[model samples]
Target: MYLYGASGHGKVIAEIAEELNISITGFIDGNADIESILDYRVIANNADGLEGKAVISIGSNKIRKLIALRDNQFDYVKLISKKANVSKRAIVEEGTVVMMGATVNSDVQIGKHCIINTNASVDHDCMIEDYVHISPNVGLAGNVEVGEGTHIGIGACVIQGIKIGKWCTIGAGSVIIKDIPDYAVVVGNPGKVIKYNEIQKLSQ
Candidate 1:
């Protein structure tokens, strides 16, 4: 599998690779012209050899897309770190990464292309929809439902049995104590709706 991103997030993902004993070919980044990520060289510019099995390490949604547009050849591979605790009852779909120190409890369903970042915990019965990103140190209590394309911020915490809507953005360090509406931007202790995301259609 190939890692797509050579800088910060890629570094973290590489550590995860080490823990899992998986072989990573190299990285794909726009910033650095440098050959190697620690020890591996950045070869295959278009990433033709590793399509559909490479792990994308792009942090933000925008950057992820940018890199994907640059070289959409590599299919992002999913990585579940060895240190992470994933229950047998949990279901994580393809192209999703469960990073190091994270815990996914029983009966949790994670959708496609989602990123469950480092140290995050998703308790039992949580349904995380597609393209959602649960950042580092985020915690979701039991039966929490996160909608599609929602990006939970770093260090955020969601209470039990809450339903966060689609395309919602939870602010960093915020505590979500209520149900969020679709396309809402939520923040602070109670996680109020600060703004609503305008829905845009992608080109076919």
Candidate 2:
């Protein structure tokens, strides 16, 4: 396996791969300055001629999506840390990474390229769409539905059955008790829509 994006995120994924005993061929990055990470050779801007599986180790949802869509040669692989407690009934799609100490309960469906970050708790029957990032220590109650490209920040909590819309950002340390709309930027306890992300709307 190879990791794209030779940065901090890639380093973490590399460690997860190590725990799983998966052989990492190298690291690939667009940045020419990054020569190596953790002793693995960094191939700069040359994804051509590469075969086998790879993971986009980028933290940004948009960048992950962009790379996945643009790079067609390599098959994406899901990396679930050996230390993570993922239920057998949970469905985690390709290119997704479940970090160490994360808990994914039964009947959860996590989409492609999503990040279930370290120590995050995803309760039963949750639906997490593509490119979503459930940051470290975030908690999602049972049956919560998080949309595509949405980012639930570190230590955020979402109540049961709440539907967070696409491209929304739930701020770090916030508590979400209500449903959120698309492109909304939510914060504070009980999570209010402080503002709409007009830039996201324009991009989409």
Candidate 3:
């Protein structure tokens, strides 16, 4: 296995790789300044030697998607921690990672390049779209639907059957009860939208 980054996100994935006992060949980083990560050597760019399966250890949804799209020569590896409790019925797509202590209940569908962070709980039948990040300690009740590229902040709670739209951000410690619209930045105890179309605009 190889990692496509060597920064903080890469460090977390390196730990996951170690936990899984997967031997990392090296990290393919563009930055020449980065020498090594936790004793693993950093190769300057993928052309140096990287091939076959690798994971893009980037935290940004936009950059991760871009890298996935741009790099078709190498296969993307999905890194699911052994410590995570993912039901056999759950469907986790390629390039996604279910971190340690995370719980993915029955029939949950996690899309490509998504991050089900440490200690997050995704309840039964939840649909997490592509590039979404369910941050550490986040909770999603049964049948909740998260749109593509949306971010559920750490410690946030999504009530049962709530639908969160694409590119939206649910602030940390917020309680989501109502459906959020696209590109909305929601926060507070009932998850009110503090901003709208801002995320989309920034992306554009």
Candidate 4:
């Protein structure tokens, strides 16, 4: 297996790969300055002649998507940490990474290229869409639904039955008790919309 992006996120993914007994061929990154990471040879992201499965170790949902597009020729693989408690009933898609100590309960459907970060708990029957980032230590009650490209920040809590819309960001440490709309940036106990995602406009 080959790991992409030889940064901090890559290091964690490498550790997870080690725990899974997955042999890593090397690391790849767009940055030319990094020659080696954790004693593994770091080559240019576009370097050729390497084959086999690859994982995108980037933390940012946007950047990960960009990098995945750049390396679309390679077969993307999922990275689930051995330490994570993922139920057999859950469905995790390709290119997603479930970090160590994360708990994914029964009937959870996590989409492609997501980051279920360390210690995050996603309760039963939750639906997480593509390119979402459930940040470290976040909590989602049963049946909660997160839309595509949404970012649930670190330590955030989402109540059961709440539907967060596409491209929204639930700020760090916030408590979500209500539904959030598309392109909204929300924070605080009730998780109000502080601002709309202006980038969504440009994309359209």
Error of 3 at 173 (Å): 0.7
lDDT of 2 at 76: 98
Q: What is candidate 2's lDDT per residue for 1-204, written digit by digit as tens?
A: 999999999999999999999999999999999889999999999898897899999999988988888887889999999999999999999999999999999999999999999999999999999999999999999999999999999999999999999989999999999999998999999789999877644354
Candidate 1 local lDDT, 1-204, one digit each (tens): 778777777788888887778888777665556688779887645555556567767666544545555566666567898889999999998668898889999999998668899899999999998778999999999999999778999999999999999878899999999899988999899778988887773111
Candidate 2 vs candidate 3, TM-score winner: 2
Candidate 3 Cα misplacement greater than 4 A, ranges: 45-49, 197-204
Listed per model in order, the count of residue pairs whose N, CA or C atoms clash below 3 Å is 3, 0, 0, 0
Leading candidate by TM-score:
2
What C-alpha lDDT, on a 0 to 100 scale, does residue 94 get in candidate 1? 63
Computed on alpha carbons, the lDDT of every model, listed in order, comes to: 0.82, 0.94, 0.89, 0.90
Q: Give the best candidate by lDDT.
A: 2
Runs of candidate 2 exceeding 4 Å displacement: 199-204
lDDT of 2 at 72: 72
Residue 103 displacement (Å), model 3: 0.4
What lDDT score is found at residue 12 in candidate 4? 95
- Clashing residue pairs for model 2: none
Candidate 3 lDDT for residue 168: 88
lDDT of 3 by residue, 9-33 (tens): 7888889989999899888888999
lDDT of 4 by residue, 26-140 (tens): 8988898899998898888574766679988877777777777766878888989989999999999999999999999999999999999999999999999988999999999
